[model samples]
Target: MTTQLLSRWKRSAIGSQLCLDLRSPQAYQIRHVAPSTNIPWQQLSLRCAELPPKNVPFAVIEPSDQKPDTCSQWLIERGWQCPYVFREDDDTFWTAVEQYSQPTTPKPWLLFRPCPFLMQHINWIEKQTQQHRCLDIGCGSGRDVAWLLSRQPLWNVYALDSLKGAVERTHQLTKNMGVHDRLVECLQAKITSEGKWKTFDEDSPAVTAKNNTTATAGTSPTSGTTTTINNTIAITNGDIDDKSRRFSPGVSTDTFFQDKLGCSQFDLILTIRFLVRSLLPQLPQLLAVGGYLVISHFVEDGVHEYEQPRKDHRLQLGELAALYGSMANIEIVVDVIEQIEDGRPVNSVVIKRTGP
Candidate 1:
């Protein structure tokens, strides 16, 4: 299709329904049309199943080196309606869209900074194989998730948190950074007990369903929201028991996390600033052979003063390492207690699974 025609179509209401950017995540990062869901050309075949229904009209923004006809033909064969493909060289399309600009300086928020320990060991991480999958447990606001996505073509991050607001914030950060292509998934879940995780579905009857609200799937990532493809299953009905502070369940929570993760093993699993001792035993099972586990959390040192004196939440010296002492086929890369510039003493451990 001609650039002018595509541009005019994009302005129409129908065009707003589905606009895809069929460029590499790297290319999309450099420049892409706003509101377009980015699914890299290389991943199109693998992810096409997640696209909107066949009846929905969609358009694709192809790279300069790719043939528009070839891409459209591939999609057509896979049940996608004839998709409008616009080449990168189309000046009219490029001139009509707004390009994202990178910030000249770092922001002051600590939430935006990558953990010092992660940064220090990034060289070791890069030396491993490509296309690694990482899971961030208790991923508040998803600082680490954003960092992993920034290392695109290398890592696919899955972030989880119990707070709905935190999960939503992570989605916003991923959208703002234009790295939705690298984020595997972000879920609202809680690791409440050993080997048991629960996920909250807002569309459940106890929440939006009772109101007769219909939930739509295949939402644009840039729309500042994230949702699952399956809306059928939900952990809770939104009824919270006051004494226990837990939501009333509508379904079993046993396999909810695994179902959402879509994998039993991950290349890396990170838990930062949040500690759950119950999850320690399952770390070995979650990590693939040669996979790494990085965890960092606050420690109770008499020298440091705290606003809240919750000793149970603070780790004792060498306590973090002791939890993994019985785990087999793992090598400890780094285990130490260090005080950051902020005066918080943290126990950080980086271990690698060496056996199947």
Candidate 2:
């Protein structure tokens, strides 16, 4: 398409269209776009006639790392009026010079494979899944969600990530792929830590008269602590019962997070990067009798001071899966994955809770 038309095509305010690299006599052709009439850059002298007329103000997007000036020079010599130039555009024609040269895909590149670390889990997802009530808990770029949805558009999916940027990006990706209504449920809720929460003072002059806000649940601002020295009240929900409870406050669904995922409970819960101990125990309860829990993260070798993941709030040992192994009704398949990134080897574990 002409550059003018390309620019006018609304940015979609979504995500960029991702495509395979194309080069030479043939290229990665989409169903809608015709086969690109591409010839090697070296033959520009002979290939000049194959291009558009000289009067057409054509535009070209060069791979930021490739040679654009050289290609522009050749086009000019052939009487082509190529008036526009772009230093970076990974999704488009890249000077036509790199029809064969492919050390890698262009920069700011998304992973060619979505679930690289857990191919087994992906395969299991494809084979064992009866319904596509899939939830990608930490979908970075919607790759897995897109891949699965494209494989089965009828399946229901909830794509979520903690990072707002990633959630929006995934939402855009789903929209761009025409799966907005099928596989896109972008949310910003985060996994609450299992750490103990204590109440803080809610009284003193800071307590409002008009707002009608008071100490909720198990906590009310202590009178003596109003000086900010001795006051202590725990985090409480804005409910009568909340004021009665003293610990693990907040409007968190620590008990039934999975039930609130969708209509009932998601058949598949995909989590990466985040970890919580209490969540692990209830995961089995969240699933239908035969629901699957697929998880992957970096594992510790027992050498670290704490059995904690290096950066994220992930598990240290691969025992989190084994934590539920004692339950005979569930099938626990847990093991360490291959080391491909900068850290120690990762781990992927799946637990399919069965009926007794």
Candidate 3:
């Protein structure tokens, strides 16, 4: 069986310092799979040097399982020096399992990003976001929240969730991770929903009604008796002025440093595997003047032959990158990755907003 040969080949490959696979001539011509090759049986005698340094175990994986009995007998009599043969019917499951058991991954905190995607390219982003304040949006069970905090204990974490029991569960999870203090109480606010916060037009009507009644202001000239101007109108020229209307200053995260109940101020923000169109454009503003952003998510490539994105809120391919185009410190991420060094399939990008 092929498994038995691979078992022996894996062992023999250890001391030789080189492992080569000569699979098929056609396969080599088409894709030329990296680290795998095809060495024709007839030409190998003249091309043995074309194979790799014999300093390591050199293997020739051929598609042939049947050979002349005399050919088998001749190779059999040649001792252990003959190239290991990998045939088509060889069941390689056991051999792959044996090789997979070896230690992999840079460290153990990456079980969440456990695919050959995003985490493979995370080193630079990780190094940049570590020491800053961060918020992990859509933190389901706090697994990623815990992983990020575990790497940098000094960083403050605002773990947010919109589910019914998400806040409580995040509390329990972070407590289990022994990082409750670093984690701010879970925010139960829904990032979506137009009614989550009272709209300006809706909120303004109440204030306008109030101002019309009791608030004393310079009166408009009646005609003959009074000739005075009234500039105290709540609506400026029939439009609501953001500066004049009680600007909610809307729950900014900046209050943290002032020892006040902060509105959500963070030096860095992270959202992974989640999308909301309204939130996309505001990503640049969430950070402080010089804040950084790290976002990773599933993006379409415009090629999948399905109904295309149009007149909808869902992000299309390259949409996330385009959102911050005019921003002073914007960096857009593209998903065309060259290396699979990390064990996951991921699309990730880091944006740094330089201070004005």
Candidate 4:
């Protein structure tokens, strides 16, 4: 594969293909193929979102000592299409990088837009001077997380997602935006009933922590913060929070959050485009007094072309208002079904935990 890739590079200008140098930044700075982006091999999983669409073909430049097979397999598994692998040690490869090093017009990088609902209502956070904590549930791709970090310098953002890939993408996106330092953590665990989320896979570590703390199985750090795999519970069609009118007392939801998230409460809690009826009861418990909770997703009556949410997952009309309205110490800030330009109706609600 290296020989063939080198042959192709020699025949055509190296500028023709999108090249990703998998070597470390230090090594890449010393010497690397011209017009190549440096993303270390180990960071590839987290930073994979920075790459162009999976359909676009690209080349991988790896360290001379390692086999290109590993790099190729990793890219393929991530849905990245056909990759051309080359080693830095190859004389032909080095010569081609130098010979055809002239810069080519760069391709447009992919753009990620933040959630519109969050953008409109999140103005209050930026006005405050004191540092605050925020939690984003189902933080797919981390657009909102990155936006919050970029917009408010004093806020420490935490992200959660059930999928490992989603967590990785969120981490990488924040890192790319240069706000990763303020990103408290990204948790790869499903929001099961209270403490039901247990580690099912220890082979893959759940998080990268600071100061020797880790979410890997069997090791309980004194800090009470932990991580878990994407283990999920049964999704019921009925609204348990509405029916019960109060969260169950058995599981002790606060303990689960304290141990998993490291913090028992957040100033702002958001779950966008994600619906789990049973999880609704847990949001208020996760919010501190005077903090806000936001929920937005497709509604059952919403007319749209997209499918797969199923009737069970979509929120019923007035469901958000009814559920949170009856709950004590809760105030509904905003509750309405908004229609975007695409004609899709989204049920959005914002509420504040007014009392303990």
TM-score of each: 0.57, 0.53, 0.45, 0.57
lDDT of 3 by residue, 1-356 (tens): 55565567657734221223334556535432123434445544433323332223344444444452333234345432335554433446324534433433232212122222334544555565534677776676666666556564366777665442445556765564466777764654434332121112225333443343333346432211111112221222222232223322223232322333253456667776566655666667667655667766554544333332232423455565666766666655433422223222234666776664
lDDT per residue (tens digit) for residues 1-356 in model 4: 55566557545542345677788878887887666677788887766656645655677787766775678777889787544777767777676567656553232222334667887888864453244789888898887787788763468888887655567778878766677898998976554444344322334432233323224344333323233212223121222221112112233456657776688788898899887677897789888888888888988774565565777778889998998999999999899888643466789988998899
When 1 and 3 are scored with lDDT, the better candidate is 1
- Lowest lDDT 10-mer window, candidate 2? 223-232
Clashes of each: 0, 11, 17, 0
Evaluated at residue 343, the lDDT of candidate 1 is: 69
Model 3 TM-score relative to the real fold:
0.45
Candidate 1 per-residue lDDT, tens place, 130-168, comes to 548898898876777877777735688888886665677
Computed on alpha carbons, the lDDT of every model, listed in order, comes to: 0.66, 0.49, 0.46, 0.67
Cα RMSDs, all models: 15.7, 15.2, 22.1, 11.6
Top lDDT prediction, candidate number: 4
Q: Residue 292 of candidate 1: its Cα lDDT?
A: 89
